[model samples]
Target: MNLGIVGQAVGLFAVTNIDDVVVLALFFAQGAGRRHAARNITVGQYVGFAAIVAVAVTAAFGATFLPERVVPYLGLLPLAIGVRAAVRVWRHRGRGGQEEDERTGPGGPRLLEVAAVTFANGGDNIGVYVPVFATAGIVGMSSYVVVFLALLALWIAAGRYFATRPVVARALSRWGHLLLPMVLIGIGVVILVDGGAFGL
Candidate 1:
């Protein structure tokens, strides 16, 4: 109900998730024309984001589901995923008629994969959200959560739109598989550096 709270929620979500747009786009590109791709992505995004919010809310309420010291290690999730993707790409390269392998390999961006990546990418979000939720009263927090969920649909739509664009779609179709590993690896490295995970 408070305009201030609504604005803050919007800003925070945008700032934290702008990168997610690109990631989601890549996923859409990879999933283009595949059965259940959109549904898997949508469900995965919600599941992943919901986990992040739950962690933040729990921490705000004084529960340490994940200790602060352990937060940085969360980067391992993405890092491992990226490495695995890269390895798969390498192994399957030049193996023609492997479209099915490409699609079904490692389960092909299914709900669990997307959810894991989303959750992994959201480590920083939890850090940002915990303090905000702590300060926000129950009403404010609820508003923020509602706005976040609603905007999530918009984010998915935006990603799909970008992926469907003529030029972007072509590029993604050609290079999406390649780009995926790089992006995931890059995200993992950034999270690790930002969280000082390596030092720990």
Candidate 2:
């Protein structure tokens, strides 16, 4: 149980997940008027992140069938999601704000939907996690999981705090429709480039 390894795990997770905070903040703002918004997001994030950890740990073990190059293509999931969101916003612009609000109501974003987006957004983490888990023994991996889960709670709180702020929430509500999709697309491109999927 090296403290250094724990520190490294925390650092790596925090650094890679910094962008998630922004995304999560937008989710919070989107669902601000919804009941169980925080709970839904918390559950969704855990489910989504658990899938990521499962994949990374499995790869760390003996499942080397999936190539490192192919992992980058997973970015397409988020890219598609972003494009869909952008289209929805565009269509809603012609329909009117009330229609959009009714469609995406207080109970709009379901747990599975958020989970899907979170999983998609988190696809890039596989690259970092696989290499880290390869070197980490069972205890080290366990430590990483514990630290990550704890930090995840903090991350949720931060997003909720931002969403609760009147000015911040209003700003996000106003501009998030335009920005979130672009951000997701950008994340996908970064993942693809970083992974050198097409040798580019």
Local lDDT at 28 for model 2: 81
Each candidate structure's TM-score, on Cα atoms with residue i matched to residue i, is: 0.93, 0.84
Off by over 4 Å in 1: 96-107
Over the stretch 113-184, how does candidate 1's per-residue lDDT look in tens digits? 889889989977898899899999799999999999989999999999999999999999888889999998
lDDT, each prediction: 0.88, 0.78
For model 2, residues 25-137, the per-residue Cα lDDT tens digits are 87787676667777888899889888888888888886965576677777776677778878877878876667545634557445876677777677878778987888888
lDDT of 1 at 160: 94
Best by lDDT: 1
Clashing pairs for model 1 are none
* Worst 10-residue lDDT window, candidate 1: 99-108
